[model samples]
Target: MRAGGTSELKQPSEEVQQLLETVKTELEEKMERKLDKFLLVSYKTQVVAGTNYFAKIDIGGEELVHLRVYKNLQGEVSLHSHQHPKTREEDIQYF
Candidate 1:
């Protein structure tokens, strides 16, 4: 997994690095846009019967996307992404 903080960006393992590269390439190809820089944040990992990894990717401030990567016992890997939800405040009226 990869994470960014005040100190510096933590380096991800070789496998994670490769996965990120693949994701970037796929996004570029599908979107037909060049991705300049990516900021990875809120990286977390969970291990059990399988491995689950999650993180958020900031693409040049234009968009923030959520990433979910999973690896199963059979060594199968799955990557999925979705648009991050925006936070908003609204007045609440209780009945």
Candidate 2:
């Protein structure tokens, strides 16, 4: 096909190609950041079901606070404002 042809063989303009490339690059960076954050949180946090986490949430007007359950390195579950940690078996109610 001839250069800059008007047929189906024609290629996209430089401006369009650059815009697409920029968007792809931006999306990749954004996803990478999000994945990193998720990995960090997952490694340092416990995997509790959605229902368990939602049940602890206390929403008061514009203020929003999440109540997340975390397990220690020794596999002990704990609740906020509690002095002592409880064993996994004792934390069934949170999950």
Candidate number of the best TM-score: 1
lDDT score of model 2? 0.26
Any residue pairs clashing in model 2, and if so which? none
Residue 94 in model 1: lDDT = 12
Worst 10 residues of 1 by lDDT: 86-95
Clashes of each: 0, 0
Q: Which is the leading candidate under lDDT?
A: 1
Q: Model 1 scores what on Cα lDDT? A: 0.52
TM-score, model 1 to reference: 0.51
Candidate 1 local lDDT, residue 9: 30
lDDT of 1 by residue, 29-83 (tens): 6557787865564445556456655655666655655566666788666665444
TM-score of 2: 0.18
Candidate 2 segments whose C-alpha is farther than 4 A from its true place = 1-10, 30-95
